[model samples]
Target: MKRAITGLLNRLRFKQKLFLSYLVVIIIPILVLGVYAYNQSKEMLRIQGIQGIVKNVDTISGSIDGSVERYNHAVQSIVLNKTFQKIVTNDYSDLVNLSYDLQEYLTPYFNMMVMLDQEIDDVKFYTQTYVPEYGDSVQSADRVKDEDWYQSALKGKGSQWFSDNGLIVVAAFPRFFSDKATNLVYMRINEASMFKNVAALAKDGTVAITNDRGDVIYSNQGATGERLEAGQLQGMKEGAIRIGGIESYLVKKTVKQTGWTIYFIVPAKELSRNAGSIINATLIVIAGCIVIVLIMIWMFSKTMIRRIYALNSVMKRVEIGDLSIRIRSESKDEIGELTNRFGSMLARLNDLIDELFRNKIVQKEAEFKALQWQMNPHFLYNTLSFINWKALRSDDADISRVVTTLSKFYRTGLNRGNNMIPVRDELEHVKSYIEIIQTMKDHSFDVEYDIDEAVFGHTTINFILQPLAENAIMHGIARKESGRGLLRISAKLSNGKVVFQVQDNGIGMPLETANTLLQNDSSGYGMKNVNERLRLKYSSDYSFTVESAVDRGTQMSIVIPAYLQS
Candidate 1:
């Protein structure tokens, strides 16, 4: 699988491959962490919710215990009162005196005590001896004594709880009227009113209070029928469980004094709903971040790939011998540096090729010069013998002067094994050639130099001028009859380049014939050799312009790079 993916990647462009790799490297981690974090966060929030609910249950349980404590203390206050004990244990013969004493002392205290607690519904005292009925509260003693609560209050010791289909809490204590018997004090508070705050706090779910006997006492939802079984409440203190038919997360806190457990119940799905939303939101933001990152990676990779594609395209052209290709490398990264290096390498390769070609041309020129030198001696021997004979027979110094000019021409033309010579030497050699031609032709052609004086010391190819001058005299001036033909040569510098021209005022041919003469063939070696030699020595950027017209003039101009060897 890995190899197949790699092969497919190799077939794609560099930018696509880089974008894929970066996405995998970056996005995979983001996705993996996003999922992992989402799940972990959801679970953490669930636990945290359970903890918060447990605290809520504890707060409610504490409030219930506080209310019960206050009720019990109020009863204890009444039991410890000496005045109430003396009144209950009093031997008042008349009920009227006792009624007056109870009303004057206890009625105002009961009204004041009821005013202190909002949940306090009634505060009553049951006594077997005195004020059992109408003296303190009811009008008949039988009505009070006949009640079960009055009888139970005498038997019961501490706080007692009884409900008349509604939740109720009673604070009962003994009033020690005498050693043999004791009266009871009862302080009752409405349990429904006491648990109202706890019920309000349970807006999301149900809150219930159950006694130690597995009987539910009070519920926030007013559900007192169903209670947690002892088996269900056995081991689990806090967890999710089914109560009756409802599945809920249950938090249980047991009040030590009352042995009543406060139960906070929320639906299992409700506990996770808020936490799930938070986790989902986090995942969405992470996905968005991943998308933005992928876009940036693709953009960066595309820019780099564009540069590489350009380099590769230019290299393809270079492969076909077009070495003029160049890349605009302005970046500073490693890839940009690589592009710059490739450009440098191509330039170096082009230079090496040009150098090799120049070396080949130089070798060929040397061979041509060697062959020409070998063919020169026969002409020299015959010419010297003829010159000597002419001088001996005619007794004329012109023949000696012609022989001397020919000798100087050949000597300077050879130039002691150097292809490059000063402009002065070339002009002198051409002057010797013109002198020979003037003698041979009865002085019919005239040659003049309008050359720059500074151009004399400058370097040029040896014998270049002499050959052009010879071509002028032979091809142009010799064709004209009875005309004093003129050949002009000039040289100068222009725009950092060296330029010189050869002109002849004679029977000049047409432009087509002038161009045909410069082409190298079996009969056209001189112009071709000069053109090739100049191109090899300098660059191929030099120019050779030919201008000619019938019976007017012909001009052969050559431009080469300026190089002064000091």
Candidate 2:
């Protein structure tokens, strides 16, 4: 059976195999487990919903109780003030004294109480004593004698909180005077400030504060005029119940300061919304897991196949004489190890090629030396000196100078068959070549030298500068349309390296031509030859760079490590 199953899988395409395996390994087991988890999570969510509602109701109860206590204390403070009590109970004999005393003392005290608490709208004293009403701060008791809140204040001994149309009214009866007067201290508090927290907690629900008589005193739903049914109030003791034809969650807590119950009612659908969201999230996560698994399977197969194809490509390149190709793989698997071995083989082949190339260079140099030795150096110098003497005798200064400069140029360039020469000697050789060219051209161009004295002690490959200077004169300076070109040769030592530059202000070549100048060996005894000689003598770090523009100029730079002659 195992062999049959393996054969069936091998015959399927890669994507088909992935989908079939995923259906068996992940989809089947997850569907079964997801059903079981949903059943368990539904029950847990309902219980936690009730607990959360209860805690929220308790918090609202605490906040309402704190507001009530604060207002009660404020009322009590005014009632106990002896000066206030005297002002309320005193009977005026002279009308002028009464007006003066009310303006100077009582008016300022009432204004201060209203200023201290931003929630306090007004502070008034109601009394049957014969005192003039002063700007709504004092009023006659006859106006509210029949009111229920006033009656409750008259009957109560301490401060009592009363709600009238969502407004908070606190009244306190003072007993500090012996006149036995029906005097009440009344304070009105802003209702919105008192119930702001309840409004915040009742987003999708209704919150109400109901008195013992089941009358809604303050409701965030604007149902302050409604009264809770006796049956609904009784059913609240037993958890959630039907309220107004909807099955709802009821959480109620009694405000300890006033004996008022705060009721929080949320419909069943609203409470179960979170559980529905959690179920939808679980389904999405399962679907996402299946998608991610499919993607991972595709990527795994593609990666293996891609590496194999890359190895094949590398082998094809090696067949076409391209041994510089490299494969950078960190994997330790069989394919990765194969790639590593291939790279090692390419490296060995490159080393062998370099060895053969160096041997060829040595053979060519030996042939050049043999050709040089065939000529007698003393005889050549003597013949050049003899021609110089004849030109001088004939009174031809230009010919004599040219011959002398030619002799000096050859002497410096030969250097007794040594391949390396001092930087000073190389500079002198190029100077002689420049002098010969200037004499030949009738001094059409200017020459400038910016050689640093520090480079005089260092040595470099011979004939590196002469070929560059010759190219500058032949290709750059000689083609200037301005008829007077400037040739600047500069050498400097920087950061343990020596840099030499040959620049000319002439009709320059295009960037494409400058780029290919040193890339091939077709230009014999030119820029290519100079670059090859430098590469063979020094490390590969040595480089040549060329810059040119049509109207601007051409500048060629050579950079090599500074080496002192031993």
Candidate 3:
């Protein structure tokens, strides 16, 4: 079961989980509360029904007691009257007439008793001699007349005016009317009237009275008469019995005066009918709430799921080499922020890739240039060799001197095809090229060198100085006045850099052309190639600079970072 539940949960969507959470957290609680409310309502209704019955029984008993007291007062007034004594002791002739007048005077009292009994569904009587004329027609015995109550009524006993019943089902009050002689009156009451009164108060149920022998004395609406057997009556006297399946409440009270029991039966069904309505209403509300919660859960889950899918898609594309793909999310939440940052990272990655490609191309071009510079000097050596061989066969002395200078120039410049050599070797190559030029052309040019001997063995590209020297002597000197020019070559240590300068007093170039040659903005093959080689050897720190003004002279500086002779 546990594994099955785990699998079910794993297969369910986020929305399903959200809905289930609502069921556990909200809907279930609502159902529990509904059940709680139902039980509370049932209990409250039962309590209300019981309280109503108790109140009705208490009110009826009070009214009956009040009526009995009023009758006692009337009888006391008649007993203290002196006129009533003379009628009993001396007026034997008018005795029947006096009794008739007394009955007539007490007509309103009898009518009052009838009205009270009718409204409460009970009966009442005030009797002295079981008088049929006085309307007291209850069962009585000759022995009952001589009972303690009868004697007490004949002459008021113990200053006792009245007594209250401690139990239900029976009640009685004895009243005496004496004439200061042997004349007296007595009254008694029982459970019959009390039972009838209890019945009047009952609705939707029953009420009854039972004697000490457990016999049913009275009942209302035939309900109590049919259900109350002798044994049931005894049980009522002891305590109320709640019958099963009858949705009812029962209360019992025993009358102290007559040992009779009063039983009240009330149906719980009638009082608790509203409980069903409350439960139905509660269920309707809970169901509505569950629906609302489910809708909210679905919407939230969809929103969350969609964002996660979008992020996953972005990652998949990135994994497949689509580095340019980006997530476009406008929400200012955590997921949105994460996507935005990821997009930015991808953008940076694409930029870095492009930069790396460009760098690779630049490196390949530089390698090609280094290879070209390696081959150029070998070609020049072959040309100079042919020139020297021709001059030797002709036996020309000046040409021989020129050929020898030229031979030494090419040999030193090539340095046996080695690209790097000592700084002094390169300078000597420059001097040999100058000697060749002086022999073949003219000695009108003045040459000077200002170099530090300590830096003579430092390594440099073998033919770099010679090219500048040749350019100055040929193009620079050929345009000079009188065919004479000042040539200055200098190399020294300056601020951890090898500072080398070659200046010629000859026709100078325009600013634009001078900048183009030095900065190498235009690729005039020889100058651009030389500049590129320098860059390949020493990066941006080592390069050429040219300063020139027309007819003023041209000066060039090649700066190389200083390093040891090795």
lDDT of 1: 0.73
> Which digits, one per residue and each the tens of the lDDT, describe model 2 over residues 1-566?
99999999889966577567666777777788688768877887787677777777888988888888888888888778766676677655677877776788778877887788778887888987877677798899999889878787777667777766555555555554467677888888887877888888766677777776566677655222233543455546636777667677877788887878888887766666644666777778778877887787778767657787788889999899888887667889998899898888888889999999989799868855764466677898999999999999999999999999999998988888888889999999999999999999999999999999999999998888988888889988887777689999999999999999999988888999999989866544678777777877775979799999887889999999999967
Q: What CA RMSD would you report for each candidate?
A: 26.9, 10.0, 32.4
Models 1 onward score TM values of 0.41, 0.60, 0.35
Q: Write the residue-wise lDDT of candidate 1 on 188-217 in tens digits.
A: 567778888787777677776777666667
Candidate 3 at 378: error in angstroms? Answer: 8.7
**Candidates, ranked, lDDT:** 2, 1, 3
Candidate 3 TM-score versus the reference: 0.35
| Candidate 2 ranges with C-alpha deviation above 4 Å | 1-27, 87-351, 360-376, 389-396, 494-496, 521-523, 538-540, 564-566
The segments of candidate 1 whose C-alpha lies over 4 angstroms from its true place after superposition are 1-33, 90-93, 130-132, 135-156, 167-182, 222-238, 244-246, 272-284, 287-566
lDDT of each: 0.73, 0.80, 0.63
